[model samples]
Target chain A: MGAPLTTRGNAPKQDRSRATRRRLLQSAVACLAERGWTGSTVAVVAEHAGVTRGAAQHHFPTREDLFTAAVEYVAEERSAVVRDLPRPAGVREAVEAVVGLYTGELFRAALQLWVAASNEPQLAPRVVALEARIGRETHRMAVRLLDADESAPGVRETVQGLLDMARGLGLANLLTDDGARRERVVAQWAAVVEAALRG
Target chain B: MGAPLTTRGNAPKQDRSRATRRRLLQSAVACLAERGWTGSTVAVVAEHAGVTRGAAQHHFPTREDLFTAAVEYVAEERSAVVRDLPRPAGVREAVEAVVGLYTGELFRAALQLWVAASNEPQLAPRVVALEARIGRETHRMAVRLLDADESAPGVRETVQGLLDMARGLGLANLLTDDGARRERVVAQWAAVVEAALRG
Candidate 1:
């Protein structure tokens, strides 16, 4: 929006340029979630997005540039969703909504990056910093959406524990379809959160 | 302990053979934690354990064999610990102990393998199966240790949620030392578990 990331000077092609960039990002996230880091080559992602490799490269000059942008794009989308939400009707509904954020392609993609970064010297610091920022922002968003009083004893930690549980469920779900079990656990956490916050 | 894994039919060398295998397994886990899957070669592990590559190969012919055996050995050791643990005086102690188990080298190594397995077709299914079995065993052990009654509403999910929270804490700790925050979160989870199980 500021100056169009992919191109310049060509006003007529601006919207199409933006659209292409968006598609590349979406494809990167989806590819990462489905195929993990090893399968997520820039060429592969461009092909998956129905774009030429040159166009993808034009938008993101390197693999790290592409995937990191992909994660950032999705995370921005999540923050927007959290901000625009209708303020959930109850504690259980709010808990479910918060947990829902971690179960999506964004969380899965970030997780893949985290794993890749653990041994990658260049990626490690970038990922640690990015994820820490995301963690803090998401915590702030969750606290707002839950109407939590962090000033209360243990309230801050209680909120963090909920997010941690949500992350754990997300990790566990990566390998198997633990839907029914996750649903039960989500409900249990809502009760716990409500009680913990009340005290 | 049974028939010795690294060597066979060498009665006089059996003890040394067992010791070599044990060293290899421990070194593999440590290497995986420190260097990740990409650096955890049999040669490197052998070197780290002060053994020859030939000796490491004698124990585990393949990288996959070495890593899988390392995970299995550590998991078996964990099961033994659970079986041998004296009953905790209360929920807080039990929760701390369970959380402690997820914070060690084994969890770190397993996480690296999980990231590796996610992208590896040959290793994916085997890791999945192994992890599922381990998850179930850990769940059973936690239930026994927590003295949880699964027949009660949400009790099983509560215990699972606690473990999920522990896993999340482990993941969080991987990138940075979130010790102070994690301590508070663990204390909060202990309280939640006590409350949830009481019902």
Candidate 2:
């Protein structure tokens, strides 16, 4: 896979510092996805970024610092995708757009980070917070689209349910080799969310 | 709090070996929940179970074996709870029963185990398998309740979606502090499931 912003080798020559920071985060994500959290280290991350360990340290003083940056980067990327959605033509379009964001590559990266974070006591809180932020943002969008209020009975639950289904779908998709099944799951999710909003 | 079956102090007087094994698994779960996957250790688990390091090793020849047994134990406990439900009187009851199991102690323990396993490369495949097995079982139960086959349009998707909602509810409940809020989430889950089944 191409290095994310964290790869120093891919950074512009004019922006050494910014490039180094990006490379570190990108490298951290790669290390986490390929070798898992336990196997990830500053030296490895620096090597992955094609930079010296000192450069990685300059960006992130500790492994935890690097992990936090990586997770934040991933979360921001995911948030950007969701926030960039063009105004939906209608409720149907909103549902489809939400599904698309949740099932996209950015989401896949987030899921990889999420799986790693869940097992990390220090990182779990940050991961949970990140997800909660996303949930609140997405729910706001859903509420806006559905013309529903926060106090409406079952509205929050339905939104949370939809988000959860999307996450579960991503996880299942990652673990399984079935494309047709993944599509079917997404279609089903869209239907369920549509029904909830319609109600 | 407890040792995997091989741990010493918690072993049964009637069957020392069986007791040791039970203690180790319990200890492992408690240690995992408390310290997380990375921070947990065989020595800590042994200490938690009130056993010596030697006893812990005698019972579980390796860390992988110990973790695997713990995974199996937790999975079996969860399966027993869900599988024990008698035929539901109706769709509503099935929905409630399923939702209840998701929010129940068994699922909570399983969730903790799952979070811990997510970080362990060697443990992840086993966790994925266990999760798939549970999902399939849930699907079968839903199929019987819905009176539909896998090929039936929306049947598989609906079943899978409901399971996702239940799981999401469980995690949400775990994260929230308010007891009343937790109850509301459960009610909302039941409501959504009932609505879907009605359609």
Candidate 3:
């Protein structure tokens, strides 16, 4: 993975540099989703972004740098999407929305990165830290979206269980067409969560 | 990955051949847990098994074959462990046993394979089929152990959700030391399960 490139001789126009970096990060995510971590090299990302190798290097010097940026970039973009979604009216709707959030392209890209990071020594620490931050943010978002009562006994665990099950479903979907089964799991879990809230 | 080697020339003594195969499978699991898929090459597995390259080759011809066998071997071993574990006296104990079963070395080995199979085209189909089978068996066992009423509304979903959550916890434990948090999730979930049963 590439290290973040330091600003070099005479800062390039800020807007253009930012745009180039954005493009590279987007390209890196695309590569990760389609080809996985090993396949998504700096050169490949640059090519995908239609930028020169030097331009890519100027933005992300190491593969780690590029991957780290991509992971953060995708997480923020997904978080924004979650934040923008209309607040769900009931537990069922909330479950559907939350499950949808987890089953999208963002999840796939993140899964690829997680699998890659799990094996790579150089990338493991960064990925672990990123996942922790993302997991916490995701949990917070879910609690808010569901209007879940944190003060209620077992509420936190209920929320955590929902999030974890969504992740497992996301993983299952990665290998096979698990949409039907995933829907059932979500609905069942929604019922459980509803029961907990009421009790 | 190695393809299963056909019996070539007078089969070496059956006992010795079986022993060699077992050793290789054990070595492959150890390698996967420690070195991951990319690093657990045929040469490395053979070296770790203390078997000559030719002897290892006589059992597994391709890396895929070796990994495939190792996956099955580990799954069978784990299934036996689950089968032999004393049945729980209550839902909480059942949950603890199930959770403990998931958060062990077997889960780690299986996880490495899952991550590898996710990215490797050659291994994906086998892994998918194996996972589906294991999942179904696991679900059945959970229902049995919990004495869950299958005909009850949401019973299937409850079981499925638990399994999915356990898998998620297993995945989380892979990236970080999530033991304390996992215990909380398990305890909370067990309470929910007990409530669902009584309700």
Better of 1 and 2 by DockQ: 1
Model 1, B26-132: lDDT tens per residue?
89999998888877888899999999999899889889999988988888888998889897888988888888878888999998888788767788787888898
Model 1 chain B is weakest, by summed lDDT over 10 consecutive residues, at: B3-12
lDDT of 3 by residue, B1-199 (tens): 4434774433557768888899999899888877777788999999999999988888998888888788778778777877877778999988877677577666776777776676789899888888887788788788877888889888888888788778777778876789899888888989988887767
Candidate 1 CAPRI level: medium
Residue-by-residue lDDT tens digits, candidate 1, A31-68? 99888887799999999999999999999998988998
The native-contact fractions of the candidates, in order shown, are: 0.59, 0.33, 0.55
Best by DockQ: 1
Q: Output per-candidate TM-scores for chain A, rounded to 2 decimals.
A: 0.92, 0.74, 0.89
User: What lDDT is reached at residue A109 by model 3?
Assistant: 76
Instruction: Show where candidate 2 strays beyond 4 Å.
Output: A1-14, A87-131, A140-153, B1-14, B81-125, B138-153, B171-185
Give per-residue CA lDDT, model 2, range A14-131, as digits (tens). Answer: 4778877888887787677556566778898899899998878877887878876785686576566656666677655665555555554455445555545645667677767776
Which of 1 and 3 is ahead in DockQ? 1
For each candidate in the order shown, give its overall lDDT on alpha carbons.
Answer: 0.87, 0.65, 0.82
Separate clash counts for every candidate: 0, 21, 18
DockQ of 2: 0.29
Strongest candidate by lDDT: 1
B28 in model 3: Cα distance from truth in Å? 1.2
